[model samples]
Target: MQSVTLSLFRFGPLRARLWALSQMATARFALRAIPDIGTVKLCGSGVGEGFTPVPDTSVYAILATWPDHNAGRRAMFGTRVFRRYAEMADETLTIFLTPASARGRWDGQTPFTPQDITLDGPVAALTRATVRLRSAGRFWKQEPAISRAIGKDPNVLFKVGIGELPLVRQATFSIWPDTQTMAAFARADGPHADAIREVREGKLFREDLYARFRVDAVEGTWGGVMPDLTRRPTSMTNQMKVAAE
Candidate 1:
């Protein structure tokens, strides 16, 4: 599966409306023409310190996954619909492509079991959760501790931008061995519980958005990339194809 994250940044109060417009436009095109496209997941809009904050006039969007490079290239370059959406943006657009190798599944509402998650394809399981706290002011002080606690967990792949924006104070992105592991972390309320309490008691961020997915495809850099270089290694782009085969 080919996975790509398109992040748009908008500045000013019209951010939300502009973002909504882009989403609506993209959804229409994706639903009709984008093959193997999964659910049109909406995230990062809720009020929380850990969420992505757009300028009062700025907005952002994340697009993940296409079946292959051709499909991905088609959606971004060959298609008029996506190009039109790009024209609506005011600032520079950023895109990241990564391969998603399925590790597991998340069965909503129940404790996830090993048997419940499937890794039948080259798909990555993507799950995101967010909560709004009552005391965002005090929560800012604990950013260091929060980052430390999260980093201690070996299962977590990466956590970036700690204490960056006031509205979206913290954001974490990680890869797990399987769905069961991810579920265990979610259900076993220790560190997670403590963090939730901190947010709630401190009134940090409000609203929690949670989602899990079976990554169907990925595109772009699978191995890695060197930004200083203009040309990417052929092996990196083809990594997913090799793995899927």
Candidate 2:
């Protein structure tokens, strides 16, 4: 089973923050050498509303794919690269997912392999794009409104704006109770909808990807507490295990 893991690390002290920042470039080497690892990205989050020109600097993410659940778990919990980030961060959270549907590419490579099974409960959506140089200004101009809209969106169970590069390359990951609620937000009349139209007409991105996933399980804490998983099925709930801190 193809699995994807998004590991978030939140740093507290200046030293830890700096180390996290430096690893955005330095850690890739270690990640590439890891066994069973597939596509990987070292991402930084946007400041405040979470879609901005400025980065938060304190929060970072490692998005990786694995051959199966066991391999993903081993890498996240056992590898030196992951353990180092965990040790340095004040808080950490990792979510495991199985792709339900996916299209497009990231950095010219398709990262997720979709499963044929239907998803019934909590769903997660990941969208990534590399803004064309000429379209950067136009792309970012929509950010304030889109960020505000998403921040105020009540249907979103969880959301974060993270990217490999600030400004030019960005991605947003959000969880919803179901696919219907998630699609409503995307189709609704708003800044996000407006931006979607503009992107299509303008051909704003050099590369882009959109994927929907079934939330297999999640471990650890985000913002100092675990995300409520009561909405997920008992089968997935049974799979949840808090990773050693």
Candidate 3:
């Protein structure tokens, strides 16, 4: 599947309201077009320190997929439906669209395992709590540590960096088994805790954190142009052969 990361950057006082309005507009447009186009599986938003590593304002993220890159681009940038909402975005909006280069070990459809657990509760409960922390700009700093910890867990799946969309700062795209695993990592009293504390103690941001999530239905070309699932090869040749005219 192809994925696009849209990051909205805003500062000053009215950042939160403006960001919310823009997302609302985008969601409305997405919902209306779902029937004609592919599904908009997941959308997420969060808060983070700007490029300077200091809490800036807010960053919004949306994870959308389509049968192919061409369709996805049309749904997002080509139509006036999304454009109406795009106008509401802050002056400094930045967007990046990248394909899932390679599928991870746990990338495809599969049941989540115990390693997905972040807390000893229901998935919904954990997702809510972790989302709160993310909105507070707590999870951004601890990403590396969190990734390392999850990597050690055998149940954990592959980690892919979809590339960052520069706006308020750097925002990335990653897929997890479920919100439950994500919560366990965020709520743990580890590096994530320290990161959260930094935000709570300091009046770092001007508004609440923002994020959205959607499950994706992926299709289309694999290998060659995309990263290899097995390993990063030194070089890859096009596998699709053209027919004689």
Top candidate on TM-score is 2
| Residues 1-245 of candidate 2: C-alpha lDDT, one tens digit per residue | 89899999999999999999889879999999999999999999987454577888889999999987778887877899999999999999988888999899988888899988677888999988999999999988887999899889888888889988888988999898888999998999999999999999999999899999988778789877999743556465345333222
TM-score, cand. 2 vs. native: 0.94
Question: Residue 154: error of model 1 in Å?
Answer: 18
User: What lDDT does model 2 reach?
Assistant: 0.87
**Which has the better lDDT: candidate 1, or candidate 3?**
1
Residues 117-191 of candidate 1 have per-residue lDDT tens digits of 344322223333232454544554554454455557665432222122335433444444456666666566565
Against the true structure, candidate 1 has what lDDT? 0.42
Query: What is the Cα-based lDDT of residue 103 in candidate 1?
Result: 30
Candidate 3 wrongly placed segments (more than 4 Å): 1-16, 19-26, 29-37, 41-44, 49-58, 91-245
> In candidate 2, which residue ranges exceed 4 Å CA deviation?
48-50, 233-245
Across 1-245, the per-residue lDDT of candidate 3 in tens digits comes to 33343333232247554664456445656545653353232223433211222322343334444443345445545666455435544432322233312221111221111121122211111111122333435444455664455456443332322212222223333334555675566677875467557646764433332232332223122221322222212221111111101
Assess every candidate by TM-score.
0.43, 0.94, 0.35
Name the lDDT value of residue 228 in candidate 3: 22
